[model samples]
Target: MTYESSASAFRHLLEARRSIRSFLPTRVPDSMIASVLQDAQCAPSNCNTQPWHVHVVSGSSRDRLSQALLAAEAAGRMSLDFSFSANDVHGIYGERLREQGAAYYQALGISREALAERRAASLRNLEFFGAPHAAFLFMPVFGDAVRVAGDIGMYGQTFLLSLAAHGLGGVPQTVLGMYADTIREELGVDPSLKLLFGISFGYPDATSAAAAYRIEKVPFEDSVVFHN
Candidate 1:
């Protein structure tokens, strides 16, 4: 746990992980998912309450969920229970958002004016974007929100890194919140818990157009603040 070694490990993981949008048809083994969940459980929480519950979907259940989401999205039957928003974008935040969108659409060959096509592409977000494994994460209502949120962030990082280590990839999604009602009913989620987010995991399809997008990270100095 020396500083240098930990930094090296962190850098290596940073280089290895990517937001994978296209996945191969291969199924993710339950054991592997379980192990990732175990890694996620190492995330810190208030009094070690953990406060997170996850529902995993695959096989026919995954397919059915995808279909339900797509149908709802198509019919405009979606509603958002919560959302993350930037009320007023400024400087690097706005720039980063635009740049990422440009890069992604360029890779997919999707023109901005192609409204229907863009809508369809966006609906992919609601469908776990076709990844073989879809996991929905929730937080219990009684827990401290800030602590629970931090726990979720830690679990997410661990889960994504675990997938990267296994030659797999994942995309954590917020759009899934749009179909939360349907998702809750379909998955039999408890009323006391709230949907935190959804993550799609599987072997990435390297040749896919969406997979070709090269997401760039700002240089460390540009984003970091150093003390004298």
Candidate 2:
């Protein structure tokens, strides 16, 4: 393909990719999963440290982790490797978060006033929204997690894009990282490795409410500046 065509193809995939919250129960072919993993390995990291340590779980292991996550949520168990509080974020970032939440809840047919329903719907993250697999990304702390997290985020974007290229989709669940100790113990991960986040992946169920809507993004002109 010519350079322009190649760039267009990549842009198409990039723009088409979205967080897929509802998935068909069918497992992705092992070969396809392997190919996607290989593609994600190409993501660049600081000084090529390649700090990502990924664990993909399927079938019985997936179910076990889901159960463990739900139980932990019920028991108010939380062990975070990094700190995050919605209240700490404000202005444009917080507004964007609220907007996203509103759009998602609306798509799910839950009214803004339905707090209980929203909470229940949020629990679906633990269930992987019926996905057949989940991948947990972990990393070691070096100095601090900010830079490490940026690398992991890039890795996650590559993984998501690769899944899209392979006719699959995934939702990156920050909620999963809330139960760091639970996940580590359940998956036999070393204590030294801290959980970053997880991606639940499979064929997206187009008919599901989760796929019913996608919100518009801020226009380029509103967020970008040209300095010449």
Candidate 3:
């Protein structure tokens, strides 16, 4: 393909990609999953450390991990490798978060006043929203937050884009990282490897209401600073 054609195709792919909340129960082939991971391996990292340690789970293992996570949530036992606070998500970021939540809940037909229902809905993360597979991303601390997290973020974006290119869909759930201890115990991962997040992936359920929701991006000028 010509450079212009390739650029246009890439732009289209970026526009088409979105977080898929509901997935069909059908499993993605192992070969395809391997291919996507291989593509994501090309993501650039500081000093070429390639610090990502990914664990992909499926079938019985996936189910067991989900159960453990749900049990931890029920028991109020959250052991996070990294702290998260709702108060930290304020200002324009908070507004964007609220808007996204409103759209998502509305699409799922969840009532804003129904606290129990909302909690139940959130529990679907544990089930991977019916996905047949999931991948938990882990990384070791590299002495600085910027280098470690920036590398993982790029790796994750490449993975997601690779999925999109293959006509698969996935959702990155930070909430899954809250049960870090449970996940490490279930997966038999080394305690030193910190959990970054989990991605649930498969063929998307097109008819699901959650799959229909889309949030608009802020204007480019609002986020970019141009200097001539």
lDDT of 2 by residue, 66-92 (tens): 999899999999999887788888999
Off by over 4 Å in 1: 1-9, 85-91, 142-144
Show the lowest summed lDDT stretch of 10 residues, model 3.
Answer: 141-150
Query: What tens digits encode model 1's per-residue C-alpha lDDT throughout 102-209?
Result: 888888999999888887788778667778898888876553576677677777888888888777899988778667888888899876677878889999999899
With a 3 Å backbone cut-off (N, CA, C), the pairs that clash in candidate 2 are none
Sliding window of 10 residues with minimal summed lDDT for model 1: 79-88
What is candidate 1's CA lDDT for residue 112? 94
Computed on alpha carbons, the lDDT of every model, listed in order, comes to 0.82, 0.92, 0.93
Clashing pairs in 3: none
Q: Write the per-residue lDDT of candidate 3 for residues 60-169, one digit (tens) a residue.
A: 99999889999999999999998887669999999998999999999989989989989988999999999999998999986766689789889999999999999999
Alpha-carbon RMSD to native, per candidate: 2.3, 1.1, 0.9
Query: Candidates 1 and 2: which is better by TM-score?
Result: 2
Error of 1 at 20 (Å): 0.4
Which ten-residue region of model 2 has the weakest summed lDDT? 211-220
Model 2, C-alpha of 138: deviation from truth (Å): 0.2
